[model samples]
Target chain A: MRDQPTGDQLLATARDLLREDVLPTLSGSQRHNALMIANAMSIAMRQLQSGDEPERRELAALGKILPLPESHGLALQQALTEANRALCRLIREGRADSGQTRDQVRALLLETTRQRVAISNPKYLG
Target chain B: MMEETLRQALAAFIAKETGAAEARISEAKLLTGGAVQENWKVQVDITGGAYAGVLDAVIRTDSASGGVAVSHNRAEEYALLKAAFAAGVTVPEPLWLCADKAVIGRPFFVMLCIAGTAAGHLLVKDARYGGDRVQLAERLGMELARIHSIRPPRPDLAFLEWYEEAPALHSVGRFRRYLDSHAIPHPALEWGLRWLERNAPPRGDIVLSHRDFRTGNYMVDENGLTGILDWEFAGWSDPLEDIGWFCAKCWRFGAKGREAGGIGEREDFYRGYEKISGRRLDRQLVHYWEVMAHAAWAIIAIQQAERHVSGEETSLMLALTGHIAPELEYEILTMTEPV
Candidate 1:
């Protein structure tokens, strides 16, 4: 059997197809939909590659704002860890309000993570 | 418990007033885009109200969660809308205000629905109405200038407090406090704030300021701008703030080449404003506020994104708002750094 295409290969192929065959052909509402879909895909790929770094950095930053009892570095790490755990619990319990709060916590974490990653890993593309 | 009960109460109240007894109230979905308050599309058929036609009115109220300092109370906002409408600004007519908590669990107002489009990207992209865009942009500028020209002797509207004082310092402190409350660290934003503080613009002749004058905030029809919505942030300040805000890059809706509401050149808007106001354009002041406008928008975007992430509200729009921070930051950096 022929070797299966790797995830990267598949993503590249899909992107190329979208840019060449799909985007050029679209018009009106179809063009809008295609553009939105392409944008979503690009975001998804970027998130997959560099999303975690932002999360870590954001957690660290949060620690500075709302100081925990632990040391700075540990607090940063723990606060983020606790935030994730809290989010997991809220999701599992199906608490709608809590879910919303968790989203804010997650956003802060992710944003901080992204900024930190950008500073640390200059070559990282998103 | 409250949301469902509130909806029922609201329907009952509206039904009683409108005299449409058979009106069936169904599905009250909370609409997005109002940052400081909540807006919902309440679909109901007339059963027994004073007016017999089917009613589709937007119910607006203060949000339970995070809200900004400058947000007017529902009654106040309604009053403002009525006053603005009276002044010949195209606005949805304010219908009713309910302060009774038993009705909607908070103070809220209802307004007649105006049919028009407000999406900036869609407006810019649609080739059918491309020719009208520049003319519409100019009209919008002129109309805004008209709004600023309104000097109030009316008893209903409260006189703006900071009219006599230097507004730049006040704004600097106000924005600084807002940033401090959020406690998000941004050295660049802080630097911009400091720059504004150090080089505060001299207080010019004061007039009305539509604090958030931008493309998306306005309503447009086939002819041109029909209405300018979202006066929650409206107040008295330097008129240039409004002009600068309208011309700011963030409001350009992804069309970089066209500057005036991303529809035409800045001169078109400037010419229109000059025609209406009888004042020569201050290019330097407009440039300054344009930088500040982006900074303000960036902060707002951050706040909006925060709501999505913090779980107060979750929507794709909010998520996208967060993504715009980088672009806004870049704008501030470029504007502030000397050539």
Candidate 2:
């Protein structure tokens, strides 16, 4: 059997197909749909290129800041998740009023969300 | 015949005293920009009710579910509309409010349909109407100032529970609450939230704030602004919030150079607001809230996109709304980053 294309090769092929073949044929709503799909695909491609290292780095950063017990992988994830949930709860209760309090919570939350940016696709940062 | 429903409701509620039955209802279509609420074009032909002629009206209702965190109920919206129309704010005249779910599957209200264009791009692009753009923008600013001057104290209007000492801080919290409710992760939006929290403007005098004050939210005629629609986000807050929101880049209708809804400069808008209210414009406060305005909108864009992805309400419009986040993020970065 022929060897399968690598992930990068597959993404390159998709990008080529979108620019050369798909986009030229699309019109009206179809054109809009094609552009949107292309955008999502480009983001997915970028995430693959970076691997999950960004997530791991962010998790390690979270482990340093938050109050998590010293287990490495899953514990870090759980701590990050708990921090996000706690912040969300505070926001829901409308308690994030003080500037310093809001700043601390937002810093923690931003760090957590930044780590997960790979899942949301980097091209979305455009 | 439930043909008498409109007639009877109007007679009992509106005091129009019509005994006619609606022979037919037609021309029904959904109006855009009411994600938390809905408006449907409702045309009725009355045969024997107290009213005898065909009438064009809009049926406003709660959405399948409330999409926004702080949307007022249908009855509350109707009351606010009636109060504003009575205060001469140029709104469609509210006719009747039906809280019963039997008639329309949800709480719904009816209002007289006013004829005017509400599309911002069409207003800016069509040369026939384009000449009136700057003048209309100024007039809109003046009219908004007039709206701000209205100080009704009815119980229905006094429901907002903003923090007494620090309204600006409370506003930031409310926006954060809205974002948290959706639970979608956005690094850029989180950054915006953090920026706004760190740079919160000091609270100023409170006024009746139309939370969504912008070009697409208003109706325009050949002369000027005819009415401001979408009062579901109305509440008591710092008036500069409305001013900053009106001048935000997101509402510029594709004309990035024109700050005032892509129709005029900031000077013209400020002059109109000041002339009408007799209050000097605070440039610094306006600029600060303008940043907050974009932050709030960024969260809203995320929520809209999430609605489509979550299978809550799937539509091309919702999907396009999600695309606006990139531009919003760029605005936030430029506004709050260290100089």
Candidate 3:
């Protein structure tokens, strides 16, 4: 088991300190840099909190769209990349132009992008 | 901004180029915010020549680190600036181009500097600069119309590629090709691309487009616009492409309520364009290009982040740029969602 004050906790604490303390002391590009660092830390914390659950969910979602051998052994990240890449081909081929497929693809893309935004910048989701 | 040897070479080159007894660089300060280009603000004093006075200029050259494949080199950018200047576009006057790399270790050009700030975030909020927002928007529109006046078939700009596909479709194809080569898939971006393909504006009057036209790309003083800048991405494309790029929500810099580049209403900008081009803008067509603009920005963001991800450059800014893609993707998704 991981110890207390894990990676996310550390990042959260650091980001709070940077935003509250360091940012006020900085100006110009230094201020911009501090804000960007704080933003990166927040993103890291969000990703850590969410863990690999988003990727796992993404993989399962991709499995529904792309045809593949049942239970074909592949790692989570690799399988996700492969499946999403295939979907890219399908979309480009106009297979998702207008129909159930188009609607499903749109929904999937929206959901997946929302998931990414959830980690990268949740405020954008508004 | 310049080493001793480079400064000496530049002085010699200026002296020779202007038929001056001597040219001395009083100051050379590297300006910020051009990721691909190095822009050095240079102040020069010339003696015994037609240009025999203190002059302010910008020395522009490619960063040795290289840039996107689609952008033109320093020489091409210089030529584009000349064309824009000739077209009466409010651009920094292109003074001279030096193709000899041995002089500065890279091809560089000199242009008369315009006084203003070009930071989008500042321009949007700070009334201290950029003058009256409505007039600025109108002027920007007029400037864009003037830029679009420079049509193809010119011998000098023969370097620009002539494309058969509608500009929108061409852009979508380019993005797809990039995604195909990218290490990972971007289904959100692809979704935007598909919508663009379905609704691309038809191939129409081809004109020179300031492909990177946006709030940050131009400069404005307390009174008004000083000049349009950044022509590295200049190319032949449908005129609406530039308009879309200019008015895209992504370019608004958080001043979403204002529209027309976060400065004025859309009609004011369009009216300015109409005053110059004597043509009306099709709102529907402009919307399509706005969607394309988001997709284009997302691609550029991904490429920048890749520069950091692949270790070609270690930069916090580049890594942060990667994070912006999701926001852009969200914008794309919202814009392309069926009514």
lDDT of 3 by residue, B1-339 (tens): 578898899889988989999999999998853557888899999997878999899988877766667789988999999999999999999998999888888888999989988999998888788888788889999999999999878999989988888888888888999888899898888878988888877899999999998999999888999999888889999999999988998888889988898878999999999999999999988988899899999999999999899998789889989999998998898998768
lDDT of 1 by residue, B250-312 (tens): 788778678887777888888888888899888888888888787788788888878788887
Q: Write model 2 residue lDDT over A1-126, tens digit each, in one string.
A: 635786756886898799789899889769878877776666567667767676566556545444544445555456555555544445444455457655565565554444334344444333
All candidates: CA RMSD (Å)? 10.9, 5.8, 1.6
Off by over 4 Å in 3: A69-72, B33-35
Weakest ten-residue segment in model 1 chain B by summed lDDT: B183-192
- Residue pairs clashing, model 2: B18-B50, B18-B51, B19-B48, B19-B49, B19-B50, B20-B48, B20-B49, B20-B50, B21-B49
Tens digits of per-residue lDDT, candidate 2, B1-339, equal 233564344334323334544445645566743567767676667677655678788877777676566678888889889877876677888878888876556788889887788777876566465347667767777878877886645576766554575556786676666665765444445556665666666666677888898877888767667789889888887888898898888788777688887777888888888888899988977877888888878777777788889987887667767767766766665676557
Q: What's each prediction's TM-score?
A: 0.68, 0.74, 0.96
**Model 2's TM-score against the true structure:** 0.74
Question: For model 3, which pairs clash?
Answer: none
TM-score of 3: 0.96
Residue B128, candidate 2: Cα error in Å is 5.0
Ranking by DockQ: 3, 2, 1
Best-to-worst ranking by TM-score: 3, 2, 1
